[model samples]
Target: MSMHRTVTMLAGLLAALLVGAPAVAADNGLTVLAAPPASSGRMRLQVEVTDPALQKELRSSGASPDRFRVAVDQAGAQVKAVDRMADSSRERSYTVLAFDQSKSFATSWPQAFDLAEAYADELGARSGNHTVAVMTFGKSKSTHCEETTAAGLRACLARVEGRGTDQPVTRLKFYIQEAVREAARKQPLPRGGSREVIVFTDAGEESPALKVKDLARDARERGVRIHVVVFSAKSAGKGIAQRLDEMSQLAEGSGGRYIQVGDVDARQAVTGLVGALENLYWLDVAFCGVKPGQTSDRLSVEALVGQTPTAWSAPIDFRQRAEGTATAACPGTVVMGPSQAQSGTSAQPGTSGSANPPGATPGTGSPTQPGTVTGSPGTGTQPGGALGTPGGTQQPGGGPGAPGVSGGPAGTPGADAAPSGLPWWLIALLIALGLLLLIALLVLLARRRPEQAAAPAEKPVPPVAAQPAAPPPAAEPPPAQPEPPPAAPAAWKDPFATLPETRLVVSKGPPGLEPFYRVHKSTFTIGARQGEMDLAVNLPQLSGHHATVQLFKGGNVFVKDEHSTNGTFVDGRRLNPGERVQVRPGQIIRLSQHLELTLVQPGLQPAEPSSQVPIAAAPPSVPATTPPSAEAPRPKARTLYAPARGDDE
Candidate 1:
């Protein structure tokens, strides 16, 4: 009997060892999770190791922080930074559960609703810090429960019911979009926290109103992970398969997962979701070779735990750093010394003088001081005064210099002495008087000559017989008429008048019946309002006064955005509100997504020349034939035709 007891004890010990081995292995498994919606430039991650044993071991081992390594790969570029959060608490997570209440989901409504409630309750129980929100979409979207506690979420789910039995068209894309929008409406998760959305739907039909690709893009842009659960009773077929593929893409694009269920237990789906969420470990990494708001297509992460290296890769979207926030990892400030050479004089060998010289302006002395004075001369001294002299004397009759005056050699006058000659004004007056007397004498002599000549001419000579009057000089030939100035070239007509009139054609509208508008005015308005716009478009997307089209005098057409809610686009580039951009023929103008027009100038077809009537030679000598009627018709009056406006004058 004692031997039997020993054998039983050995069996019990063996069973205990087998059970503990799996637990130990699980404790060693490393799972890394990153916050979804990658940022553009540098990203901060919070890293966690789910295994409690490993955490305790790491703490006790006193391993260097370097033991935890994080590397990021983006668009073929790789970077590595130390993981700083290996010892920190687990990050908080915010989740939003979106339900589809469209008609297609009516059959599976009860199960889907129950699954959502159970998932919410589980998440709340797992972590009181975790936040949960519930949203439902059908013909419209409504938030049944905003972020709240576990109890509140359960109560909200209980009251939720299918909208109605009416089979309204399913807008799957719209519902997905609303879900992401609603998720983003909540307060953004704290730095290093995770935000995600779980969508429950039947995947029966998709709405044409929204594109699946667009929905995915929006979710990704908002950084909200979308987890999709397609609960349906329909058998797997082409339609169902397509729906599943699209839903999977939507989830993966936003860094989430997709699950499909039919008739089986729905709890499995919820369990899988919860497991994924709970197992996530935050990874904090530093990025290099990318600027804030700059994105890279390829991003991967790897970690080193002890000696083993484990890696996880996904398309990384780096977050834009806060505008004024300083990077925590940057090196500390360094004290810098003065850079001026003069300031360093004390440090140099054999330099004993102060930076500034004695009796000199402060901070104004040069390193190499001149022995002789370099400033301007004193006020009493001339600029050319000799060095070392207080004031120099001026030589007699020489240009003035400094204060003292010296006499010129022997009889020469000093510079300060006055001249001993007659005044200059008196001498000038005498010269003027002498000239006036000479002028009077010449005038008297001229008057005497005229009197002598008159006495001599008193005797007259005998007159000769009158000569025949000269024939009147022949009249000069008529003055030649000035040649008429060459006629000025007819003023060139307005160039735009000849340019083919441009027209806007509705390229996306009905075939063979597209709307056309001739560009008659220089400026015209375009918008949705009938009375306000010259070209009115009755579409919801277009603003009341969306934009303006202007035909410039030079024949160029331009469009200006008018601060519309949905901005205008030329070709494919969006125009800044209130911006004007030149447009060319064949370019597309999009006032909104649904309304687009093409600018066109039809080619001018050359006109065929009309055959000219041959002029008949006058009939040769044909006798005039009288008509039998009483009187011949009066000769028709010659008719004149004025040229048309555009025709040659």
Candidate 2:
């Protein structure tokens, strides 16, 4: 009976505790997205707020400039302007797709082409609204492609199916710089909204001709957002050495995202990109948080979301040099950070910069700006610029600035402040009510105990069970669960699904190239760009658009130099650009310095041609020096040339 009473009381107490849970609103899901430090002594950091209940992202609406608690390391900073990306695409947005197009990536160009075309078509499918431009970068520069309609853009993208120019892959820094500058000035006059550049590549060589800081500066000055998507995802983040790949490094420096590619296929990758572009946020802050003589690339941001300010993100590495603000802290606001403690300021706890000039608004601290920025992405508001309501009168908080009064203790900004939690009285009352219920349950159980005890006297038969109970048989051990079978090996998929048949294989190359490119296309370009070229050669000597190989039906072949920086050679003789030279399957073609390819037609042999270049072999019957005329030189090696076919013949 006593045991039963103890259990009942414990159950009652547990119920009471469950009823006293404090009401917690959504408070902790703020993420500081990206902060690209600008060379102009300014920085922009993007953030996204989430609805805990819905598990979806939302804007921190009506958040004024003062609501943000920014820092450079531990020092305080101020936000000069606030801008929200507007949701509606009332105006067309300009996006530039800058692809490095390295040959190392395993890209399915036909499939990728379809994916990209679908994207462009979808953008313009509705009333034919054109929205994107594409540029495949190489050694020098190639003109961007933008069409009047989706079909035109499709055709332009189709042109990407062939190989690109002869530009070396080592010029990553130089190429990105050029792309940024071009994006800034190339948009048509009609595009009045946001400008973005999606840089794609697997890897690249860093060139010193243009410094990283210079690239960051140009991206900012041009108001272009740099976002990178790489094919080899392993190199997307920091490595074991804590060093990022060149692609990611460049992205971080330019304040761009190193978008992760979950799947190797381009359809899935492109789809995710399109969706992210439509849903991301772009925020700018004039963070002056660095201390004197202190320089860092890490940025810190926080905002008032609860009883006090909370960190928006951990210190992020922007790669660009970040400097401190001249002022110690935003006037009247105490420095807030992950480690810094908050305390009362001189002005007052609840007052919003009350000591500022007569024009100052309470929480805003700044009286000069009328309203803070407000809009979703695709809106007309540009980043790094102010877009508040039309009320900047200096007469002490009389204009739209009054909207800032909602800011309260702990530097909470107006409507952006965290929602009020349940009242203390209501919480206390519920707890008391739970306690009363517990007491009633306990009393009911106590009263029922006596009744239960009084009615339980009919258990005389239980005495029969007292006869010595034999120890129960020792429990048998349960059978062991079967181990799962080893997983089946993944099936292999063909890398060259588009080719009709295997006509050529890379007989020699770096390791892991055992089954190099097996191309059979009658005429295809070969270069550093995988998607743009027929046979991608990642070697340094090969240019972006190196040469085009034409497979003659008779097993004869022609190699035409595409005006590559390094001339192509047939048996050591340099072939001029655009000049097609005939050669046989046994002939070796050289590109630039180190790359050599031996042509082969497995089961086919073409007609033997007249020896354009002399062979050194001499018949035994003929006198070595006198018989063969000096003009008819003997062939030192077994070299073969394709007979002139068709017009050449």
Candidate 3:
């Protein structure tokens, strides 16, 4: 009995060991280093294996292409494709390090920069052909390095400072768009390569200027992955937490990862980012039954090595090229009856086959036979009149008669008639003589009127007794003049007391000083008209009334497009005509291709209300009634245009 029990226990232990060995071996230290965005029909991924032993094992096993299985599930439809890339010989990697320089990020500046440097170094070591760039954003965007080698990137990082403004606001969305645009300008990667943007920020403040959805779309279209690293000390604070959530949504939406490194060291943070890149593997996916330009089904991709599978699923859109259609040719010329001659033929009198005699003239032939009349070209009479030939002369005294004959008139066979009336000049002279006699009679009556007035002015004037003037009464002291009412205080003590102010900085024109405008009024106009617009932009691309900035009574501000020709852009999006979008303090308002302005709230806090002084009591006195004075006319309101930097007026 004891020997049987021992054999059973040994068999169970052997089974357990066998099951555990595969799980341990499956952890071959392979990680995704970079992943291309999954938008088009195919996706390319970059994967690396860190363990030297596992690399050797993979080589010795001679893992065939079939070992890597790829499948996609799109809109409930599953598709399978081949794994085309097995090595990274011709791969190129791009990395953009974006730093957030808001006030909240100042505390973590040192650690964040160190981590970025380390990340760059690791990327360079893994792939010698990799390129790197750096961008910094606070109230605006600044490009430090663009498409440079790893060493050049380091040099650019060394010059970076934590000298950002105290305001916690940052234009995160604009910076993201700018980074993607910069990345797209670089040379495209090889068939199996990848692009990545690693953003290091505390993400404490949100930008109201742009939408998160738009940023994600731009990144996907550019085929770039955006990985966000939250490295600020206060990243867990309530405000910062919300910002982090937004950042995470952006990362996930673009098929990238969001890592919270608030408590981790620089190496750990960098390692997490690198690991995500190493785990990516490329697959050449074929969408079965999908035509070019047709709306494709939602697709999902799953890559399997042995029995382990990594799956990526999303809906994709494919652009269709326009197809040309055939058009019918227009008829060359109009077709007449069968008897008609061909086009461009001259008419022949005798060739028409008429029944007229051989020696007959064209128009003088008798019309007794039907074919004789057809021989002459213009012998047929038009419907309304008896005129037969197109240009035949009329008879001397004919009235509604045939074209070639004379008609009887005044009861005779062929007599001419004369008109019976006096000439127009004799009648006109008689009317003029009557008008002259009437004028002379009126003038004679007017001259006798003055003589009649002189005869009626003989009435007499009666004499009046005059009273003696009394002595001047004692003069009374002039009444004291009321003091002019003190001038009323201005409605707003400071123009920028409550609302945010935006400074228009010229990016394209000749370099000079920029101008700043305070948004004090409820409604402000922006246009090219000098006196009509409050914030006048002189660039030719701007329309007469480009846009309007409105500050609501509730302390919120908005921007409305005024149907400008070039267009008004909030962030990078063009606003539809008459569209009104809320304006955040740090948002960018682009009036034209050449004119771009950023809204900035200068100080950290709004201005405080001014204090009021108490008035002392006054002695009471009897009131005297005074006549009311006329009210002064109100002055017309005028727009205050923002002048250029050097304009004296």
TM-score of each: 0.39, 0.40, 0.39
lDDT of 3 by residue, 307-383 (tens): 23322233333222112110111010101111111111221212222333232333232223212321222321211
lDDT of 2 by residue, 189-294 (tens): 2233445677665555444466656666556445565666644433322221111234445565554555434323445545544444433344455543344554
Clashes of each: 11, 26, 19
Instruction: For residue 252, give model 3's deviation from the true position in Å.
Output: 3.0
Off by over 4 Å in 3: 1-65, 68-86, 147-150, 162-168, 187-192, 235-239, 272-279, 291-296, 305-649
- C-alpha lDDT of all candidate models, in order: 0.49, 0.48, 0.49
**Which candidate do you rate higher for TM-score, 2 or 3?**
2
Q: Quickly count the clashes in candidate 2.
A: 26
> Where is the poorest 10-residue window by lDDT in model 2?
375-384
Per-residue error (Å), model 3, residue 361: 90
Could you say which candidate leads in TM-score?
Answer: 2
